[model samples]
Target: MTLLPEFITENGEHIRLMLVDYFPRLVTAIVILIVGIYAIRVIKRIVQKIMVQRQFEPTLSKFLADIMIWALRILLFVVFISKLGVETSAFVAILGAGGLAIGLSLQGSMSNFAGGMLIIVFKPFRVGDTIEAQGVIGTVSEIQIFVTKLTTGNNQTIFIPNGALSNNTIINYSMAGTRRADLLFAVAYDADLKRTKEIIQSVLTSNNKVLKNPEPAVVVNDLTDNSVRLAIRPWATNADYGTMVSEVLESIKLELMQAGIETQPFVKESSKK
Candidate 1:
């Protein structure tokens, strides 16, 4: 590139020189754009590789990979524009002002994004983990930037916002090796406690899915009105919860009734309000 000096005619002999010419400036701008895009792509790949090595959650890994790439790209884009003779000071000032306004307006959304990021980073639950969160009980299918997906036992898909999950308590059932099924079925107070225990033991043994290693326990947990509240606490795998809940209910109801033991009323109504 060469610089040429030109004089303004009919004016007071003032001379001006343009350095580096126009073509070289254009080339420099183009190179900056290329390098910025390439750098972001390379950084994204590196992040993805690191995440894979760390065994991060699959859903989260992809999200992080994409976010990293986009963030770098946006920064590079701003730099590229600045290099291309754009007045970045004023542009950046305007962007900052607009960003603050948007942040205030979408405060809740930002919170959810932060929550989702926490979930991804800390990983309280993962795919296939049965968890109770935001008052919904289901298996986590996927965890994303904005929401966590759940598949209910009935095969219903539920999308829960990330903000609500972080704020509320989350019951992760799969964290422990074994879970106790604290089933409370009250028998009439007059019924023989010994006979009821025997009947429950038999029912538990009959179910093949019940684990024998932990040893199931049948004991009187509480004494309710008109009944003896017996809790059938059994240890089972997370996968066994659904089957246990259903099988225990059916088997206990039938076996207890056959043994002439009456079940207690869940909600007994009185004449008065």
Candidate 2:
């Protein structure tokens, strides 16, 4: 019984010593964790505001904010653990190894993620922009973290991986705000070339959609064995390009027919001969 009391007294003294040494550290760790969390929230809000003010893409902005938040949280956790008198070097090494393994396992996805980051940062194209890349021509509908969605003219949806898209050539038609319509018309070899050119030019110039500054051009592009190919090039706003081409072709055909100009390929005329 005397030995039992002595043992209890020794344990109580050891417990008191441990509490004296670690209680402050525990309180400090908790305080750091709480403060770190609050700071992270404030930083996130500030970053979001800055991105908004800079007109950053919504998808990119949110993605970047999340990345920053998680990175800060990891650092805070490390600090909290260290403050509690726990060794962190081994923990950090393990994290590094795990990250490497994950990265190696998802090499392709990581490449895509990096590509997406580049795209979001540089902004070669944006949503609603008409772009031709990876052999697909369509308007960008959405830009996600790993893939970009495009909507074709026929309402088809295409999802292109950001990795390939970033590396490939991207032709942005809508960026120029204007597009040139290249139309070809074949006329009989016997037809008056000068008169045909004048008719085509008139049809283009009469259209309100055609831009006046560049001036519509009607040139003899090629002389084939049977017919003369006339190239009519016109500049029009992107919005008017399709409609202008249709209207111009119809007008040119009607005008040439009224003038008795034959549009039949010379093969027919040669056959008749």
**Which candidate tops lDDT?**
2
What's the TM-score of every candidate structure?
0.76, 0.89
Tens digit of lDDT per residue, candidate 2, span 1-273? 699888878798887899999999999999999999999999999999999997777987899999999999999999999999999999999999999999999999988888888887888988988889998888899889899999998899999999999998988888888888777789999999899888888888889999997888988778888889887888888788778877888898899999999996321111000
lDDT of each residue in 10-29, candidate 1, tens digit only: 33233223344555666888
The global C-alpha lDDT for each of the candidates, from Candidate 1 onward, is: 0.78, 0.87
Predicted model with the maximum TM-score: 2
Task: For model 2, give the 10-residue run with minimal summed lDDT.
Answer: 264-273
Q: What total of clashing residue pairs does each candidate reach?
A: 0, 0
Error of 2 at 231 (Å): 1.3
- Clash pairs, candidate 2, are none
Clashes by residue pair, model 1: none
